[model samples]
Target: MWPFTKRPKDPVLDPSYGDPHRKALIRALEKRKWKFARELLNMAADPDEMAFLMEAVGGVDGIQDWIGDWMDAEPESTLPVLVAGCHAVRWAWEARGGKRAKYTTAAQFKGFHERLRHAEALLQRVLAREPDNVTARAWLVTSSRGLGVGPAEARQRFEAVTRLHPGHLVAHEQRLQYLCAKWSGSHEEMFDFARGAATAAGPNSLLHELVAVAHIEKWDATEREEGNEYIVSDEVRAELLTAAEDSIFHPDYVPAGPGWAPRVATFAMAFELADEFDAAGHAFALLDGLVTEWPWQILGDPVEKFTASRDWVTTNRS
Candidate 1:
């Protein structure tokens, strides 16, 4: 997997991979209950959920057709714009290449690029009309990533959103991707962004999740051997614990539904990969059989990968 493998897979990156709520979420969308759908999106406590909900609503070609009618009915309705725009970013991301563009044909890359532009066009239109919609700005961060924008522009868009809505976890998550080494960013930049973000959000905020995000990016930047070392290294592990103490493991810790599971999975996978089973067990306990198709699926079959790591930690615990 490291130097780049020939065969590539992952039939679906659906965020509903392990949660029950999303099954009902699909039902609401099928019935055209746009009000309920809007409620769900508004209630999403983090970016992963926002990304998932948008993909579920309009990741396909035909489903977003209703958005036009909705927009015509309510010119001020930013919901349709958000759905359509975020969907473009998701479609582009789903088509993106990985670790040296393995298995990504030229046609596929071009298509993904087109989707990024489509998303930008929609987001720009909304910004021109509404001008101050932080949701649009957040999706702009994602669209910028697919366009292969440099770190500075990405950071500017991120600041524009966070300046309006601090602790916007979804924007923060996108910022992590924007600052990753694979995307013209270095490890130092990624780690600095993560640390500063988590700190700014203060105690008891989900922003601390960026620590695990930084570790994941650090692992992504180094060779497999060195990367593994860096993840489990004393420095990274210490910060991970500090992050947990400041939020996840704090006496006041609270769950924000299945939408919050990816934050835990990030640590669970990291600790498991680092051979730190106990820490992984703590993460698993919080997971409570729930998961999200992220940071984990980025490796392979997400469920299989999660189970293998979870099983390894369980054996060590017993």
Candidate 2:
């Protein structure tokens, strides 16, 4: 009677036609209309949409409310809602740009801060459910660092990640940077850890940089005759140069990976230290080419500029 003898299903009326009601609610929240969004969420037919909407607005509190209500109404199937809430919060954070703030307006910053709190709560929930979730643990570490949590807490999180997944390159790299910045140990101890991490992690460019820095620090500590520049001893400098050279062509030195630009930058530094103007010039040329070839991959353009300036100085001085 509605259309024909057997009525055809209306595609536009289907739940999957438009964006999921939950995603629409999230969009509305991002635009800062909490009241109307809540009303629309109340009218949402899908339980999953309602669960995601609750979590989107209320974070842990909303999740707990949904869990309580779901337990009373349908005890057999409440877990999915909890899980969906976790995923919703994770999606919200990731959609906002993965632990980094890219706020262009005051409204954007306010929204980001709210979403960050939600993300942290979701990660906490995930950890509670699966204490050994290495990915969640890594995200927690990154979130804490983003929120300006102390270095000790950050170190603990990074250590936990490496403990769970020893081969996590980003965690290892962060831990190395942390130790180098907070160097309180004897030079020998620092060098030992640096070398061990470099070996285990398979030729980290930061390791070479730290090793060169350690040599420079040692050079500073030693006796220097008046009017003589305090260059790292030739042996240590050569060792660092060789390490830098190896880093550039190492098995893991893919085009946009960790070892490319930093290795070239380190080589330029080493050449400048050895007073090899021509070699430094060649290294600088290589770096300049990288900037053009892989512009977005390069992390610190200022470092490249500094290296180029030094190469020019060395060339002109000769």
Q: Against the true structure, whose TM-score is highest? A: 1
Could you tell me which 10 consecutive residues in candidate 2 have the lowest summed lDDT?
8-17
Give the TM-scores of the predictions, in the order they appear. Answer: 0.84, 0.43
Tens-digit lDDT track for model 2 on 1-318? 011223222211111112355446656555645444546656744432333244444322233333334334543542333333444444444445422233445555555556656667766765776677554565555455435566678768877887876655445443443343223335565567556766665563444555544444444344555211545455655666666555543446543432345445555555565555555555554454333211111223443555454535445544
Please name the candidate that would achieve the greatest lDDT relative to the true structure: 1
Q: Which parts of model 1 are misplaced by more than 4 Å?
A: 1-24, 31-62, 72-76, 97-99
- Cα error of candidate 1 at position 64, Å: 3.5
- lDDT of every predicted structure (CA atoms): 0.73, 0.48
Per-residue lDDT for 150 in model 1? 69
Clashing pairs in 2: none
